[model samples]
Target: MPRIELKTKIRAKKEIVFDLARSIDLHKISTEHTDEQAVDGKTSGLIGAGEWVTWRAKHLGVYQNLTSRITEFKRPDFFADEMVKGAFKHFRHEHHFAEVDGKTLMTDFFDYTSPFGLLGVLADRLFLKNYMKGLLVKRNDTIKEFAESERWKEVLSS
Candidate 1:
């Protein structure tokens, strides 16, 4: 499995960053370039523990569907989601939030085992890892944009 960890500093409260991280609506906005959509399950609002979401998106010139469920959650702190059904053999994404000097320190630990064994490993080493990291970076940038401004109210207060 390949693990990609990312830490992003946001000039906002942990509560705001946490909620934005779980916001299905904000996700769509961040991934508009990929035309990502919540096709089933919790399609909107903040996703809580045990809630699953099916996402449809175009990536690398291919359209795919992936469903993931939140296995663990702690408000304004941490949460973990695992793949229920997806292209990958298995995957787990953990979101962590901490307060630092009155700001929020958000971190993502994304671990996944791609299918096709050796081919997958090669893919990760060649380009897939960077592709996934880019996606996460885009999403985090979106969350930071919203959390640091009044824009977050639109997504969280819906």
Candidate 2:
């Protein structure tokens, strides 16, 4: 398995950052570059424990569908979502939040195994790992942007 961990500080409350992290609508906006869409299962609003979502998106010149479910959750603190079905052999994404000096520290741990054995390893070494990290970074940047600006109300208030 390959793992990527990252931490981002946002000038917002943990609750706001947490809610923004789980907002399906905001996810769509963050991944617009990939044309990602939430096709089924809690396609909008906040996703909570036991909730699942199916996403369709274009990646690496191919369109794919992936479904994942929230396996664990603690409001304004942590959450884990694992892949239920996807091209990957397996994947689990954990989100953690902490309040530090009145700011929210958001952390991500992404662990995944690629398919096709040796071929997958080669791909990871070449570009897949960086690609995955880029996606997460982009998503976190979006979360930070929304949480720190009035733009949050556009996603959270509705």
Candidate 3:
């Protein structure tokens, strides 16, 4: 499995950051470049534990669908989602938030395994890991951008 860890600092409350991180609408906005959309399950709003969402998106010039469920949740602190079905063999993404000196610190732990055995390992080593990291970074950037401005109100209120 390949793992990606990212930390982002947002000048906002922990609860606000946490909610933004779990917002389905914000996710779609962040990945707009990929034309991602939620086709089933909780397609919009804040996704809570035990909720599942199916998303269709274009990546690497191919359209793919991935379904994932939120397996764990703790308000303003932590949440985790695991893949139920996707191109990868398996994947898990965990989000953690903490308040430090009046700012929110958000962390992401993303682990994934690609399919196809040895070929998958080669792909991960060559570019998959970096590609995935880039996606996470982009997502975090969107979160930070919204959390730091009045834009979050639009996302949260929707």
lDDT (10s digit) by residue, model 1, range 21-138: 9999999999999999999999999999999999999999999999999999999799999999989999999999999898899999999999999999999999999999999999
Report the poorest 10 consecutive residues by lDDT, candidate 1: 98-107
Q: What C-alpha lDDT do the candidate models reach, one value each?
A: 0.96, 0.97, 0.96
TM-score of each: 0.99, 0.99, 0.98
TM-score of 2: 0.99
Over the stretch 12-74, how does candidate 2's per-residue lDDT look in tens digits? 989999999999999999999999999999999999999999999999999999999999999
Evaluate residue 156 in candidate 2 and report its C-alpha lDDT on the 0 to 100 scale.
97
Worst 10 residues of 2 by lDDT: 98-107
Error of 1 at 46 (Å): 0.8
Candidate 2: Cα lDDT at 138:
97
Candidate 3, 1-158: lDDT as tens digits: 89999999899999889999999999999999999999999999999989999999999999999999999999989999999999999999999998888899899999999999999999999999999999999999999999999999999986
